[model samples]
Target: MSQSAAVSPSIDLPENKSGPHTSRLGLITVVATFGGLLFGYDTGVINGALEPMKLDLGLNPAKEGFVVSILIFGAALGALIGGNLADRYGRKHNIMLLALVFMVGTLGCCLAPNWQMLGLFRFILGLAVGGASTTVPIYLAEVSPFEKRGSLVTRNEVMIVSGQFAAFIINAILFSVWGEHEVIWRYMLAVAVLPAIALFVGMMSMPESPRWLASKGRKQEAFEVLSQIRSPERAAAEMEEINALSTNGDSRPTSSWKDLTTPWIRRLIIIGIGVGVFQQLTGINSIMYYGTQLLQQAGFTSQGAIVANTLFGLASVVGICIGLMVMNKLDRRVMLLGGFVLTTLFHLLVGLSAYFLPESAAKPYVVLSLVIAFVFFMQGTIGPLAWLLLSEIFPLHVRSYAMGVCVFMLWITNATVAFVFPPIVSQFGIAPTFFLFAALGVLALIFIGTMVPETRGKTLEEFEDEFKAEYS
Candidate 1:
């Protein structure tokens, strides 16, 4: 079936405005971004909850890894189909479904009777995480003006880091007050439910993606939604571009799989896949997922490790804040290149510190400092940019589908790393693991330098034309 035919035509957008107002646009962005908040909170809660969960659930190392990594496993599947779901359903509608999934999964995990049940629930939560990862950026990208797209899409990234930061603070407070209590982990897991509810309520009134609206022949609805977010003049101009692109895409088969046979489409998808792979290969999620564990390995006590891990979360939030401020000014390609290079160096230094300070009392603090720096580099450059690029890189017709495929690979790679990370650390120690990541980072750098295109300051239609001319 044609991709366009797969979507429903009667989808409704948010309440329309008579004129453009920045406050209204901000409200749309804020509401849409609740998805990112939940994504970050669910994932980050695990960083501090794992040890307590392990003890309460009688989990051994292997089961601990499974429980922690299982969410990512589900995320891989969610991401694999998330783009198609967004295309088939409206972006806003799909996110609402994801919010429901988030609440159910969080409740299940919090009340899980055993380790197996916990794993099952975590996998369910992964679906929402993966779906939000695919859907939210595309939604934001479509609603935003071309000039402001980079910064606006990145607001979701900032919210993600902010959510992680919130999780860390909550983890620290709960652990401080109730150290080792069986219920502390449950509290951490349950906190995510609040945000899930927030997402569902907020998205209920949110507008559909104007691009998605245009794609399915709801041009007036698209224009009205666009008019709310953009100046009337700018809205009219962008609506014209969207109509032209929609008309052009109408000639091609809507099935993204069939479109892949075209050289440019294939090349674009391949590049998108590369970007997703490299983003995960940087080993950032491994650190985010298990920062406390790694700090303990570096010689910190359990309490100290959790507190120090908060630093990692803070660094990410700060880094992303800086990224938001400068994203419009920098070239996307350059930001990614610099991120890879800097992260590789940080990885090497971390490995070396582990080797040289294996017996030092200050080992944990030194390693912690270095890891926070690594996160800063990652969040400032690759973390936000990866999602931004994925949202913007694909042509209008297959943008969501292509993003889903790319983020699917991303989640799979993340799951693989998370699953094997414990064994790798147990067998070889933290030092060697950092070295391994450093090696992968070198490859990521090469891929970015050679394969990634600069997408800054261009309309989606402009990119579509460029890709068609170059590869089609």
Candidate 2:
């Protein structure tokens, strides 16, 4: 890609008129983001539920890690295949199937008779999570008008953090009410089933992605879907561009895996993978999945730790809201670069505090404050930006496959961190563990500064043309 491409100015498109069409688009976004909500709740409920689950399930540290990380391993597989499934079956159809999987997995986990059964169900749940992660953003991106794309696409990020926040609150409440009960974790896990059912029912009325329809030579069907969401004039105009791009030899959609061997496609894949991998390297999930334990290690009681961890979830929710408000006004690359710098600085501060601060009552508070700051910056910037970029950067022909491969690497990295964090933190201390993350953050910063391109203002077709012109 050209250096100038990294600094392209925003495009000015005609404003979308507000009407029933606008309301319909908003409704669709709400329905689709339930996938994100489930993703957040299922992953985060583990933070508080794990302690009681360990007691009830006779879990060792290794078993605890396996139970938590197995879902991520399943997610990796889901992401790997999800893209192709969406490409083959259609985005809306793929999502509906995933919702059923979510219900099954959640119920299975709720009724699991043993630790092994819980792990099996968790992995099953992960497949739904992974599929949703890859499919929902693409669905959002394709359906949204370019001007509102940033905020709309990032709404999934908002729902994701909100779900995490809900999990934390529910976990705290259930733990307080049933702290004596061995069955409390079952209730926490079962909450996910409600959203899964909502997503399935809600999507039944939702339209398929117009772009996916155009790709499959269903242009009339695509236009009807677009008309329901956009003004007739705007929908017609957008369809012309979609059709033109579809017919153009230079931008033809390629389904074969061999097309990935093309240079420009390979380059985008690399950048996409880098974005996904570095997002995980931020150690955000480690904090999300183990915040209670980390707080306990800092000297709080188990109850206090669980309560304190809710603050982390709250910070993520607030941060993503801030991210949504500013998303359209800022450059994607700048937000990512700044997020990395701030998160890395906080990682260093966290390590320093854990190492230099005395073992006093104030130490945990100080560390907690620093971690909150880190999550704030992370969720506000990198968290949403990573998914937004992945959704935008690929050419239409290869978007699903490329995103799948990228998100697959992402979940793999997440699973590695989730599985190893306990053992690493147990063997080493929090300070050393954070220091290692700080080191990884430096490398991630370098990658973002050098490789990430600007996708701030261009429509999907325009960006694809620019990339093809620059790199073909």
Candidate 3:
């Protein structure tokens, strides 16, 4: 084929031809998605650990907010710089480095003598969390076969929630076993170190992303990486496509911020940021980060709340599993719209249950069920879709940078919500607080309907051309 012909919008290649290739791809996915697992455990551990940590450190509500939200602030910075690092160094290197940071931060939190020290360590951990959030999905997307891209990329999403569920279960076990110990929170933070070690050790044998290698003019290495994960025929065909796309000048290695100033790129960035911001505005993290507190306020005792919050974590894991099963089958835009609608309705119901339900013993259960439903819809739809779409929408050259920016904003929004939620609930009550989320959910619905594009069933290159043609 002519170079230009090979650079056409799409190319067909063989399907599922090599068992070894599929196993290698599966292994890579498992190793790389350790980042997602760490992201979940680190973030979710705080939900249950915070109460005991507060007691141990003598933290007031302000310090509690600071400790919870500081990591997110650091995450914003991490997401910003991580993309540049990945673009320059390579995805595998970036993730391995993040794993080390995770170990250091986890150890720091575990050993900290004061809340301030814990906050400092948590901020360090946030860097890894932010980097993983941006890099893992991109790595998965680039490495996955086009037909299985959605499900494979979203496997990271499943691991993420699975990590959270593990943390919740672990925290409950620890709290139940050592509830009297002031140091239980330290042990909770310590569990994360093992996975970090695994990620670092596992990634040593993993290949660099072929798309990334191709972008950097490393065609031979790119083909070698692809050959490990694709049938020989398919590998050669894709290498041709990657080479043609690289040489045609349609997608250049992003040199600096100047390259992303084009109108279409700007539009993609906006859409990415909107998707991320809306995902956070669903108040999902508020629940994830403060589920115990919310449960306590709703009427559960401290131990009871800790145990009940596991249910939320379980719902998250289950919901994302469902999302993965249908990830390739469903249209991205439709899933996003349906998720927002369902989550918004659940938000309203939760608020109403808290507002009008009398102080009977059943009120907490009612509110809990509604919140669980909200989590189910949000995780299955917005949770996976936000990261998947962010990974998919950007051009190869700017994928890291664009995803970093969007996730940076997403973390910022998450920080804002985390910092404010306690005060909002304390001042205005849970009803009003969730009602506010419901209001934002309405706005999110509008944004998705108007701005988000359908990305299902298209190769990254094809989607890029289609998006540019329509939006540029």
In the order shown, the candidates' Cα RMSDs to the true structure are 5.5, 1.8, 3.1
Write one digit per residue (lDDT tens) for candidate 2, span 358-455: 99989999999999999999999999999999999988877888899999999999998887787788888889999999999999989988888888
Ranking by lDDT: 2, 3, 1
C-alpha local distance difference test of each model: 0.84, 0.90, 0.90
In order, how many clashes per candidate? Answer: 2, 0, 0
Query: If both were scored by lDDT, which would come out higher, candidate 1 or candidate 3?
Result: 3
lDDT of 3 by residue, 164-259 (tens): 999999999999999889889999999999999999999999999999988888889999999999999989988887776777676676646776
Which regions in candidate 1 have their CA more than 4 angstroms from the true location? Answer: 1-20, 250-253
TM-score, cand. 1: 0.94
- Model 1 clash pairs? 3-254, 14-207
Local error of candidate 3 at residue 310 (angstroms): 0.4
Best by lDDT: 2
Question: How close is every model to the real structure, measured as TM-score?
Answer: 0.94, 0.97, 0.97
Question: Using TM-score as the measure, what is the rank order of every candidate, best first?
Answer: 2, 3, 1
- The worst-scoring run of ten residues by lDDT in candidate 2 lies at 3-12
For candidate 3, what is the TM-score?
Answer: 0.97
Q: Candidate 1 lDDT, tens digit per residue, 1-472?
A: 1111112111222223346456777888898889999889888999988878878889987788788888998888888677888887789999899999999999999999999889899999999899999999999998886667899999999999999999999999998999659768999889888878988998888889888888777899989998777777767777776776666653231546776567887888888889888888888888888888888888899888899889988999999999999898888888889999999999999999998875877777888889899999999999999999999878767778888888998999898887778779879998899999999999998888877777776677776676577665
